[model samples]
Target: MQIPLSQPDITQKEIDAVTEVMTSGTLSIGSRILEFEQKVAAICQRRYAVGVSSGTAGLHAAMVAAGIGPGDEVITTPFSFVASANCILYVGAKPVFVDINTKTLNIDTTLVEAAITPRTKAIVAVEAFGHPGGMVEIEQIARRNELILIEDCCEGFGGFAGDRPIGSFGRAGVFGFYPNKQITTGEGGMIVTDDDRFADVCRALRNQGREGMAWLAHQRLGYNYRLSEIQAAIGSVQCDRLEEILENRRRVAQMYMTRLLDNRFLILPTITDDVHMSWFVFVVRLNDLFGPTERDEIIKGLRASGVGSNNYFPPIHLQPYIAGPYGFKEGDFPRCEFVAGRTLALPFYGKMTELQVDHVVAVLNEQLEKVQMVRKPRI
Candidate 1:
């Protein structure tokens, strides 16, 4: 009955791909990396893709390659992993925190325009927890502002809005190949873009500013963020099965919704009608009825019952680094900060079975019942 919150769906294909790369001896900047790049680009319908060490590297490269540097401000949501904001600081650029929509939990397109200024260079919008983040509206904002946009597709690869994938909407969309992503590359990332200039910049930045191949001449100073052939090979193999993985994840999401339908003490994650939602995580927000301290108690109960659950992220601005020196505080992004303390991610992955899913939900309901009983006196 024990269920993990997230698990990589690795199989024999990943093994075979890695073995082939190991035997080739051309591990770094080899054919495998090239192959994986092509596949990743094709998935997003982008003309080019450059593989890198991780999604963080992909975001950093995107920001730098787009000519964003000291004093430039990148508008982004505070309701995501720290890496999203940290990438902005890597280029010596400032990350301007913006609010997120309460329902979709993605950066609010309505709030983005007000945040942009003359120094505003790009927008790094995360497709938080696999929802596509309403790319259509976001793109319109980008077009109007003439801002470079980097879709942080780390949690949202394989997700589309009205046929265009999330990453393809922006100048450069980045994907995470971390173990739990829709497809894993054992800690790798890809930058997909239709703009040839951006693509060249990404490729150069990933390999220490080399225009072509590792041994080639350097044009600008860059870091060694290239992905190994072994990782790319694994990514390419995983890429082939992406559709199947998305289907499985969708099925799991539906099961969770059905099971938790009548639970008034918790708010289910919301998905917009525009999204295909490649279900990366199922976030459940604790309702006020659970009382002030009940969310923490429910997590403990879920763990004791062996159902994996945890919060997705804390608000980026509220992090100590940004809060102390950058002058960010609780009331800054009220919705994001509020959600951060209440939302919990439940067990979700492509490989989970119906029985496993049911067990997780059954545990959630039982825990809620316990909380209600304990808090009845207060009510």
Candidate 2:
């Protein structure tokens, strides 16, 4: 009866892969990591992939490699996870927030070029909730503006925009392997690119800047962002089964759509016709009539019924730390804030059952009715 928000689909194959790595005793900077990287690069249709400790680490590395230093501005959406913008700050660059398209829930492409100043160095584009809308157009914008495009594909894997894979659209793209993701590597991530120099720079950065020039020689400041061999082993197995994993997730998403698509109180995610979603988390938004307070009550009610749920993201611009420093306030990006306020991420995993899906939808409907009753106008 306790339905958790997300579960990693780990099979015996993944367990065995990890066991093999443990038995080998080469836990760091070993063959497994290389194999994992190669598999990811292949899947993403990129020439290089550098494994890192986490997606945040990958993003920071990409920003550093792109030479995004102090006073440089990186345009990005306020709708994404904070790491997308925080990566800009990590490299001493300022994040320029753009409002999201209400339909796509991604940065509004039409406004991107207008946001570009001479100081703008890059665009950190995110594939929100595994939907790949406007990514191609964003890449085109970056190219015309001579800006580095860093695709934060952490929430999107095995998805495509037009004919190109999600990670292949940018100069460099990052993917996360958190337990709740499409695949799990315990805690790992990757930076993928076609540029050899950028790949080498990231490899050096991930390993304390030891560019194989000397084992102990430090060429520049770096971090211990390397992924462990054990994590890579699990990741490699997950990659081996990537297609199957994607299919299962797609099925789970379909089940949710079938049950909730017609509900007037909810606004389900909008995926473009050309893109095949890889369903990171099944998030549904309460209609505009219902604000955050009512959304919160439904979440509370869901939790009481043992059905897990959460707000997928709060507006990154509105986070006190970001807002206080950047002078951001309400109405700066109303679309992102509106969606952020009402989004509810439901229990989602590759192996989620139809019965579980039905139960969740039923509980959600009941909660919505209760809220509507309480907020009804005096008659």
| Candidate 1 lDDT over residue span 1-379, tens digit each | 7888889988898898888888887888778888889988888899999999999999999988889999999999899988899999988999998899988888998889999999999999888887875678888899988998889999888888868876787898998889878888889999998899888888888888888655768988988999998998898888898888888889998998988877787888776677788878888998866533687788888998888888778788978888998998878988887778788888889878989988888888898889889989987
CA lDDT scores, all candidates in order: 0.86, 0.92
Clashing pairs in 1: none
| Tens digits of per-residue lDDT for model 2, 57-137 | 999999999889999999999998899999998888899999999888899999999999999989999999878899999
The C-alpha RMSD of each candidate to the native structure, in angstroms, is: 1.5, 1.0
What's the TM-score of every candidate structure?
0.96, 0.98
Off by over 4 Å in 1: 213-216
Clashes of 1: 0
